[model samples]
Target: MPQANIDPAIKSVHVFSTGAGEQHKEHRYGSPLPRLLWALTSQSWIKIPVNAFVIEHRDGLVLFDTGLDPAIKSDPNYINSAIGRFLLRRIFRLHIGPDERLHKKLEAMGFAAADIRKAVISHLHFDHVGGIADIPQADLLVSKDEWAQLSAPHPEREWILREHIEIPGAKWRPVEFAPTDDPLFAPFGGSYDVMGDASMILLPTPGHTPGSMSMLVRTGDTPPLLLVGDLTYQADLLMKDQVPGTGDAKLLRSSFAKVRTLKKQFPDLVILASHDPETADILAASHSSRP
Candidate 1:
């Protein structure tokens, strides 16, 4: 779709981290070792941001992801299941202060948590949904495929905790992608426009999880952005077709190809992964050079 055809309802896009964490190098990049083996034995660790993006749309404030919850550190029973808790310790070393909570992060940005009208959840991962509690009034949007995992036997095994997600007063909406003739999004099969004006569109890019999706932000003069949550740790890796250690390899490749095709269409596309540490800088630079 041409830029002129779509209204520029988005004022700005901002990114902030609720916290940071250390994951094994094998997790970020590809590894031959099995996920369990690497989680237990890998010595290499990479620090990553637990990022969330705030889109200043004409309607109201929208969030791409909620970032990590501080209770995961302060509360012993955060994961509930003993085995889940044990596995989590081996997988991640989180560094989040009480002040780094979602509401506090938004406050620092001069926004109230209540100002969030909707949050387009990239997936049902803990880190991505952690801040939902802080914004009970906002609608939490997740792809229908991703939400189906809750019905499966053991979603918690995949680090999808129902206790936190199915909380009281939480507005969880399952999004179904509709057929679109728009050539730019046709390769993705379908899409869900977060805002009616198409300032932001959600595309199903599963592989990181069954229901994983990414957001495409097209505003006025700023470069277009794809807010990919854990599809890849870094944008360059996705460009190289490098699959992470976990998730379905076959499916990841499929999603990677679609995103790569999108990049070719919009040469200046800014691909921002949720955990990519360089996201904030890249976002700033993209806007700084905007025509």
Candidate 2:
């Protein structure tokens, strides 16, 4: 799409890290050893940011994903299941401060949690939806397929905690993607236009999770931004067709191919991943550069 044809509803895009976490090198760069082997025995670790994005649209503020909750560090009973808690300790190490909470992060950025009109969740991972409770008034848009996982037996095993997501007074809306005739988005088969203005379109990426999705932000003159949550830890990894240690390998490759195709269509497209350590700098450069 031409820059002139892009939507101008988006005024600016910003990102904030709720906190940082340490993951095994295998978990991030991939490993030959099985997940359990690495999770249980690997001593190598890499610190990564738990990031969330803010899109300043003319109509209202929008969040790509809510970052990690501080409660996970403060509350011993954050994860309900004993096994889940044990596995979490072995799998990752989190570093979050009270001020890093979603509301506080937004407030520091000159935005209020109440001012948020919509939060397009990329997936149901605890870190992704951690801030939902802070923004109860906003419509939480999650992929229908992702939301269905909650009904599956022992969802917590997959790290989808019901207590936090199904919390009282939270507005969770399952999104059903509709078929789009637009050539640019036809490969995705369907899309959900968040504002019904083509400013932000949600595409089913699915790989990191069964129903994971990505948001395409067309901000007129600037390069288009794709908020790909956990699709790949790094854009370079996705470009190289490298799969991470977790998630379904087959699905990850398929989604990676689709995103690559979109990148081909728009050479200047900026792919942002939730935990990619370099995303903040890349986003800043993308905003500073002209299309």
Candidate 3:
């Protein structure tokens, strides 16, 4: 979309880190065999931040994704499956304080869990949906494909725990992306305009997971922002067509190419991955020109 076509309702955007975790370096980059070998033998770790974004729009506060749940570290049964529990320990090391709970984290960020109107879940990964329990009143939005995983024989096998997701009183909505005539989004094929005004849109990027999605945010003053949840660990990797150790490699490449096309069309477009270690510096630099 052209810079002139931006909306004015969006006042500002803020990025927050709910918690931090460490994964094998190979897991953040390279092929599955290397990742497995590194996981099995190498102690080299890469710190990744579990991020959630808040958009201050005219309508209300909208959250791109909810960060990790602190309970995963303290509660023994967090993963449920015996194998999952063992695997989780080997795959990632998480560090979250008692104050890192979503509610408290939001409070620290000058917002409240109760104030969130809707939360767009990029995918149903356990870490991404962990904060849903804290914001029960907010409308939890997920792609139809992502939500469909819940009905599968065992969502936990894919690391999406149904038990944690199907919490009582939580309002979950599965949304279908509609075909769009808009040229800017034509490359994406389909999109869900979150605010009706096109200030925030949900685009199906897939790859990281079959139902994985990304959010596009545009405002009059700031350059366009794409909140891609694990589409790539880093924006540079997407630009270089490098697929991570996990997910469908073929699908990931397709999504990466499309995102690069969008970036080419809008060079100033900021691609923020949920776990990108440099997200804070990138976001701060993007807004440095303003007061």
As for candidate 3, its clashing pairs are: none
Model 3 alpha-carbon drift over 4 Å, by segment: 32-38, 289-291
How large is the C-alpha RMSD of every model relative to the true structure?
0.9, 0.9, 1.6
| Tens digit per residue, CA lDDT, model 3, 76-191 | 89888998887777788899876688888888889888999999999999889989988988999999999998888888978899988999999999999999887778888899
- Lowest-scoring 10 consecutive residues by lDDT in candidate 2? 1-10
Candidate 1: residue 90 Cα off by (Å): 0.9
Could you estimate the TM-score for every candidate? 0.98, 0.98, 0.96
Clashing residue pairs in candidate 1 are none
For model 3, what is the alpha-carbon lDDT of residue 43? Answer: 73
Ranked by TM-score, the better of candidates 1 and 3 is 1
* Candidate 2 lDDT over residue span 1-291, tens digit each: 555776699998998999899999999989998989999999988999999999999999999999899999999999988988998998889999877889999999899999999999999999999999999899999999999999999889888989999999999999999998988788888999999888899999998889999999999888899999999999999999999999999999999999999898999999999999999999999987883
Give the CA lDDT, 0 to 100, for residue 153 in model 2.
Answer: 92
Q: How far off is model 2, as Cα RMSD? A: 0.9
| Predicted candidate 3, C-alpha RMSD | 1.6
Alpha carbon deviation, residue 42, candidate 3 (Å): 3.7
Model 3 misses residue 191 by how many Å? 0.3
Residue 104 of candidate 3: its Cα lDDT?
A: 87
Which runs of model 1 end up more than 4 angstroms from their true locations? none
Model 2 misses residue 222 by how many Å? 0.5
lDDT of 2: 0.92
